[model samples]
Target: MKKFKCGVCANTVYFENFRCLNCGHALGFHPGRLEMAALAPGRDKRLREARRGPSSPMVYCANEAHGVCNWIVTSHPDSGFCDACVLNRTIPNLADPQNVRAWGDFERAKKRLIYSLLRFGLPLDGAPAGKGPLTFDFINDAVTGHLDGVITIAVGEADSVERERQRQAMDETYRSLLGHLRHESGHYYWMLLIEDTGRIDEFRHLFGDEREDYGAALERHHVQGPPPDWSLRHVSAYASSHPWEDWAETWAHYLHMVDAIDTSVAHRIEPRSTRFFSGTARAIRGQDAYRSNSFSTLIERWVPLTLALNDINRSMGHSDFYPFVIPEIAVAKLGFVHRLIRESTT
Candidate 1:
């Protein structure tokens, strides 16, 4: 996420902030401009940018009533919900306080995912040649997965303890709401960019043939864990189960890498020069991972930075921030994702 400041006082604010801490000005994220705008009351329950005055009438997304969204939309006839909230097809019951909180967590993570999609210039609505717009279902007692164009997430995933329990039960190294969303959305985009675009041959070459029976592959994976040399070929153990999964896992990691790099750069966090790991760490200052066409540059900066981060986490008695390693094969897959995204934008 990019660093934001209070337009009123220039004090630092965050993406989730609804009010500036320093100046007490109301803040709302303008999705179209992709910036946090200081808000002021306008006519008829509308808001205007504090800096721009009444000319810019805006209204908070309808989800604001539930205290889950802080995005704003123009006060036009058809603009009630923001771009992100409009994708919701179903939200967990809000009558229960716990469900509300879980939904909040899901929305927060989903917004971050949406932010990355916007940054990459990907079609949020699955436009142009897509089968339909992408939608989301935040439900309970359901498995998290993507089908057709809708992505369903089990609300329990938002509970840290429950998520961790699931992770351990599944023998996974890492798991989170954002990770689930990113991984599933990868499936949605696979339909659009790979299947719809007639690039299945290329995808098969990189990620094996998708013609393999997914159910049988998953059953076999459950019966027998990933091969001992899985790390040499796949990003995660589960990824080795199927070609589609491989694509999703690699795509999720790609999003993770780019987002982490972007956040580090925005916060001016750079890896310090040290002989402990080899030569000087790559300079990430002013680097924009989303706009860059070079996948190698991302890997170069990501490796050293993750090393420094893992060391910091170790010093604090925490596990590695990034637990997975990107083998050469995974790098090629990531590069393919990068190319697909870049080509789509053009």
Candidate 2:
């Protein structure tokens, strides 16, 4: 989540930027360099001699029926699917032109998810017996996006308008396609951690008995709202529904904090040598500085910053951007995530 700029015009850019709005310079993410760079239009968009390494050859989605994405992938890095495409458990039908548009929108968001995973060095894999590293199917089944029947991802999530409508109905501001990826990755990682033998107990204590029936739990949640006063314990209302979901919700928040802090640091948003906010005034002003650095440091700075952000959002006629409070117990859970991620790379 480092800050990026157009190499051609120096315009500040985002990881998802395909072309600079300021100068119209074509852009591609050079994962080797861990930065987005401008592509000088030619045969080879792959960046050679990138400081991190040579660029991985990538191609955009051919399903770009409406030009939603310009993402590319490594030509021969173990699969034909781009990093984002690998995570799809189901994709919409290609025969229907509208499905193509939906897929394109999904691709844009999915690529953003993949970028975070790669940026943070998270592990990724596909379902068994697939040629691709990750498998997805845009299911038309009844449970596709429902809380019932083995984790349904409703096809409607691919539609921006539909997602927004749902978000409004639910009184949520921060939900997005990328949010879905982080949430789902929680399920994937829980499978990994529980199967690891050493981490199962800790997982159970913090997230609840993930062994419980997922479908039953989800059904109960839909029928009856989360435990009254759920906010005292969980980060989101939906998280209180199940242990697996609690972990996923927290995991997504962890990523949000980590990425937000990293982006802040990359841009020198904070004055150097300052730690956590020194005084009340410092604490107020220091929220802006919290964006800098790794998750470890972010946790240190986020306490005051989140408080400030909550108040600021309230003043602006919007609900809290970060709706949940990170309880002491949740902080411990997050610490486990930080340690696990650090240990993985080490």
- Model 1's lDDT to the true fold? 0.88
Taking the tens digit of each residue's C-alpha lDDT, what string does model 2 give over 1-346? 6678877778899877778999886776655456676765334643332223444444543332246555555433455444555445566677888777666666666666666767666556523322124334455543433221123355678777888898887656567776876687666665554544587887788778887998899899888877887777777888888888888888888877776555555664533333444533333133332223344455775665566667888999987857667776777777777766665545
Model 1, 1-346: lDDT tens digits are 8899888889999999989988899999887778999988888988887876346578899888899999986433385788888889998888999999999999999999998998899997766774778899999999999999899999999999999999999999899999999999999999889985678888999999999999999999999989899899899999999999999999999999999988888888856433324666434556688988888777777887888899999999998999988899998999999999999997
All models, RMSD in angstroms: 2.2, 5.1
- The alpha-carbon root-mean-square deviation between model 1 and the true structure, to one decimal in Å, is 2.2
lDDT of each: 0.88, 0.63
Residue-level error in angstroms, candidate 1, position 135: 0.6
Q: How many backbone clashes does candidate 2 have?
A: 20
Clashes of each: 0, 20
Predicted structure with the largest lDDT when compared to the true one = 1
